[model samples]
Target: MKRIRASVIQPLLPDDDVAERHGWTSVEDPFDTELDHEKVFFNEYLTLAMRVDRWVVPGPLLKAHLREAEEKLLEKKSLERLGRKAKADLKVMVLKKLRRQLVPVTKSYDLVWNVNDGVAFFFSHSNKTHELVQELFERTFKLRLLVESPGTAADRRGLVAEEQRAFAALEATSLATMEVAS
Candidate 1:
């Protein structure tokens, strides 16, 4: 499911900082995408992008393991060994079986970096996935990431003195109305 989307940004660190960035290398086979790391450059800025792929075993699949554990626990001699430790060990066995039998669901995220602007965007709306990207980028490049929201983008747009003053004077208002009973 493609949900998380973000705008591009300038690089917070210098080009020199990117050198020896543990895993920073040219992207390969972007596959029908505009982000081609091997050849494309926009106005002297580096176009950096990559795909992060993961395998997630479905919850239902794992839940089935719990059911198996319960069934195993209820079996004749197994019922006598149904202590906490035994149940936990049984669950582990079921998990091992499930792991062997099922194929993990695959998911991929595409991230693009606007090197000149210190901005990067990832195609994910999930908070957990966003954190994963944030940590991965920081760990790989040794640089901090500032996730740009719409409000932050507007702030970065450089408003004029008078416009900034006007914006500051604005107050919050409720957009919801409650119906009153007659």
Candidate 2:
């Protein structure tokens, strides 16, 4: 049996220290200057693994399995991007045709999967668009889905990992050095 695990990441409210670390201003401030829109970005990660008891599938079969998974994931991503663009265009169309200030809703989502763990995960920031995300997965992958809040421990661990990754990247850059050795 293959196992899949996924989580939708919510934006953490930036504390003073966190803001300084990330060079961010107030957490409530909009990411972009336009429209004073406070944006929330969502990220998803998944790990997949096959049961050890099960015999390893042949190379051809494994390739087929991976290809199918990739195709489905790509299709879903394309649809989501298209939907967002269409909605934006529709908003413009509505404003021009009706002369009303109606704003069309838009959402962003992310998904990442690890075949080694046999897990797939998805994340969406918009609660209203989550149903659509779930429905798309079910239709494309034939997998039933459920949403649950992450435990405090898991959330903490994730945050720590993110901080470590960011620090590692910074350390790799010459900009972090104090003086030239020359």
Candidate 3:
């Protein structure tokens, strides 16, 4: 219980942002994986890194192992066939066991927040990574974030009513070269 209190109290937080982000992002020397406020703030920039671990098990490999396990169990029990529910249960058990022995793939992303400008940059383009960053950032700061866009940036900078309408009126321009049939 004491360890839990210090070492990132929550592991998974897909729904609850505040409760999940208590210690997951706000930390000094984030490279050490210690999520807490020690030396987090440095000048106008708030920089941190997030590490994600995922276990990827091959479907064919899992299926083969499950088949072997089911056959062994049936043979040991002297049974002709196992029930569907029993097979499903066995598959789950086998998967859990295999998952323990497998190594997890780790991914890390860095975030730089310029508080003065109220702008934060996440150094990745992956949609999946973007979602994770969004969740982590909102939870840590308890402030809503808008995805980066020209309009949003203008709005964030407190654009005047006239500039806002001008920005809204802009249309896409084509850069294609035209052929001159002389």
Candidate 4:
């Protein structure tokens, strides 16, 4: 079974570094796919974008096609049913044929890295999206990032022990379920 992989990547600032390997074009003008030093290399901040293309085949569509292909195979071989290996081969062949007629679904996300400051930001609300960027960043730069949240950020900036205790003891408040006196 396929799983969704994602992350939020932070750069390990080492004076100067850039992601140049397997340079994929941004989700902008296809013809103008430029990743130049001037455009990419901002001494303090690196603004980047990623475009991921994925082939999503519908389960029902695949089942229908596979069933039709199986029937044809059985009819051709004059067999009651296909063997396990034959079914697997047919599935692979069917997927390849279907893939040719299908366009990949593309998703784009932007990331801003502040090398001077020990922080980076990926402009996506989705946890999955954040993970994807992180995975990409790790692969490209060979660096893992620590997840930053309200508590983590506070701890990093050394918010006193008393406040840290308060942060740890804090309960999640749902605004929708709360009484708002306007």
Best by TM-score: 3
lDDT of 4 by residue, 61-109 (tens): 9899999999998999999988899999898788767766776555566
Local error of candidate 3 at 161, Å?
2.9
Which candidate wins on lDDT?
3
Query: What Cα-based lDDT does every candidate model obtain?
Result: 0.52, 0.37, 0.65, 0.62
- The candidate with the higher lDDT, 3 or 4, is 3
Residue 83 miss distance in model 3 (angstroms)? 5.7
Score residue 61 of candidate 2 by CA lDDT. Answer: 47
Candidate 4 contains a number of clashing pairs equal to 8
Clashing pairs in 4: 6-131, 6-132, 7-130, 7-131, 7-132, 7-134, 8-134, 9-134
lDDT of 3 at 109: 69
Q: What does the lDDT read for residue 77 in candidate 2?
A: 72
In angstroms, how far off is 27's CA in candidate 3?
A: 8.7
Q: Rank by TM-score, descending?
A: 3, 4, 1, 2
Pick the winner on lDDT between candidates 2 and 4: 4
User: Mind giving the per-residue lDDT tens digits that candidate 1 earns over 110-152?
Assistant: 5667777777767778887677668767765668877777556
Query: What TM-score, over all chains together, does every model reach?
Result: 0.54, 0.25, 0.69, 0.68
Q: How many clashes in each candidate?
A: 10, 9, 1, 8
Model 2 lDDT per residue over 117-158, tens place: 434465445665456556544653567555645443344455
For model 4, the superposed segments whose C-alpha errors exceed 4 Å read 1-24, 27-34, 159-182
Clashes by residue pair, model 2: 3-118, 4-119, 6-121, 47-119, 48-117, 48-118, 48-119, 49-117, 49-118
